[model samples]
Target: MVDKAVALLANLSTIAEGRLAIAREGGIPLLVEIVESGSRRGKENAASILLQLCLHNSKYCTLVLQEGAVPPLVALSQSGTPRAKEKV
Candidate 1:
């Protein structure tokens, strides 16, 4: 099922990426919680998601940016892996 796939994809590393990839497709709510959850992995994932959302959909991109995810993303962009840097 799509929900299972979605849930399965939502781990510490992938949650942000996955949410950004699927946010407007019904992922924003879930990702919001993760972003505001105060977990390191959650924040990292949320930042990644926000950047990816911006890359594909300017509208949602604005939304993510407005949510204040850019700072953490900027940090991640500096030291994250190649794939991680690419996403942010």
Candidate 2:
């Protein structure tokens, strides 16, 4: 169920409005948490959403950094599943 929700958010994040909405709704911290400890697929989806949120957007990137996403993201990139690493 959590994985499904993260996947849905990942899909939603593909759009600019959805990225704004998710960021505005305080989704960054949750995504960072998921990257830290979610299931494999959930980590992948969460990382993908975070990437989408940060893409070419310094504000969102700052928010993600402020939420301390980098450490978990780096950990995921190094040790998460293949798809999760790709997302990271």
Candidate 3:
């Protein structure tokens, strides 16, 4: 339970150093749920992770769009802090 919660909290995005690895190998549904339902920190982190994946992995970016992530990321860009906007 604790491991699950921690994974949910971070959404496999915290490790920006390994963006492609996480996006390609980890569970997308978990990250999607975090992006959709988590706190500000969570959403921001998810966006950063997505940005990295979107930049580094075409397949992941396609998945990100197919999963309807752009609208929320755009919405976040509008109201989020500068750093957040830059990452997303």
TM-score of each: 0.48, 0.95, 0.67
Looking at candidate 2, the ten consecutive residues that score lowest on lDDT are 49-58
Prediction 1 TM-score vs. true: 0.48
lDDT of 3 at 77: 82
lDDT of 2 by residue, 1-71 (tens): 99998999998999888898898898999999999999989999999998898885889999999999989
Cα lDDT tens digits, model 3, 11-70, are: 555455556556557645555666666666666666666776777678878888888887
Name the better of 1 and 2 by TM-score.
2
Error of 2 at 8 (Å): 0.4
Off by over 4 Å in 2: none
- Candidate 1's C-alpha runs over 4 A off are 1-48
- Give the per-residue lDDT of model 1 (tens digit) for 12-63: 2245555455764655555555545435555455555555556666887767
lDDT of residue 53 for candidate 3: 71
Ranking by TM-score: 2, 3, 1
Candidate 3 C-alpha error for residue 23, in Å:
3.0
Local distance difference test values of all predictions, in order: 0.55, 0.90, 0.66
Alpha carbon lDDT of residue 41, candidate 1?
A: 52
